[model samples]
Target: MSIELGVLVAIAGLVISYLAYQLTHIKEVKTDSQENAEVKAELGYIRRGVDDIKIDLRANEKQISQMGERITRVEESTKQAHRRIDQLKGGDQ
Candidate 1:
């Protein structure tokens, strides 16, 4: 009878150990899932920021091109004015 009691106690200890292992595993899985979700949210925010920066860069490029064209037109007008002034001075001579 003592041997039977010892065997039963051993079986109960094994069952308790298995339950504890399962609970620990479940907790670890839940923690990992939460962390992954947070990481995904942060990545989405970063992607949106990058897209905004790209739009701003495109607008700046367009402005720079417009400025360059305006400068070119001004330079051409200055050359034409200089030629006109030279012709007027020669006619007076």
Candidate 2:
């Protein structure tokens, strides 16, 4: 009878240890899943920011091209005015 009791106690102890191990594994898996979700969310936010920057850069490039054209037009007008002034001066002399 005493041997039977000892065997039962040992079996119960093994079952308890197995349950504890499973519970710990479940907790670790949940923690890892939560961490992975947070990482993915952060990456999504960064991707949005990069997309916004790209849009801004495109707008800036367009504005710069427009300004360059305006400057070229102004330079051509100035050269024409200078040539007219030189022609008038030569006529007066």
Candidate 3:
């Protein structure tokens, strides 16, 4: 009977240990899940911010190109005016 009693106690101890391990594991998993959700939310916000920046960059690039074209036109107009002035002065000579 003592041997049987010892065996029962050992079994109960093992079961209790297993239950404790399971409880700790469950708590860790739940914490990890919550953290994962928060990370995903933050990542989504970052993604949207990056996308907005990209759009702004594209708009800036378009404005720069338009400015470059206007500058080119101004330069061409100046060159034409200089040539006309030179022709007029040569004719007077």
Candidate 4:
């Protein structure tokens, strides 16, 4: 009867140990899920920052195009002025 009692105690200890291990494993899974959520949130912020940069870059490109057009118009006006000046000089001669 003593030997049988000892065997029962040993079996109960093993079952308790297994349950404890399973509980710890569940806690680790929860922690991993939290870490995954944090990583996903960080990625979302980075995506938004990249999108903002793209918008700013497009705006700068448009402004540069407008400046180029203004410069072209100024050059055309200068050329016309020079031609008028040359005509006046020819009449005086």
Tell me the lDDT of candidate 2.
Answer: 1.00
Q: Total clashes, candidate 4?
A: 0
For model 4, the superposed segments whose C-alpha errors exceed 4 Å read 90-93
Steric clash pairs (candidate 1): none
lDDT, residue 52, model 1: 100
Q: After superposition, how far is residue 21 of candidate 4 from its true place, in Å?
A: 1.4
Tens digit per residue, CA lDDT, model 3, 29-74: 9999999999999999999999999999999999999999999999
Clashes per prediction? 0, 0, 0, 0
Regions of model 2 farther than 4 Å from truth? none
Clashes of 1: 0
Order by TM-score, highest first:
2, 1, 3, 4
Task: Report clash pairs, candidate 4.
Answer: none
Error of 1 at 41 (Å): 0.4
Estimate, for each residue in 24-78, the C-alpha lDDT of model 1 and write its tens digit.
Answer: 9999999999999999999999999999999999999999999999999999999
Each candidate's lDDT (Cα)?
1.00, 1.00, 1.00, 1.00
- State the weakest 10-residue window (summed lDDT) of model 4: 1-10
Model 4: per-residue lDDT, tens digit, 1-93? 999999999999999999999999999999999999999999999999999999999999999999999999999999999999999999999
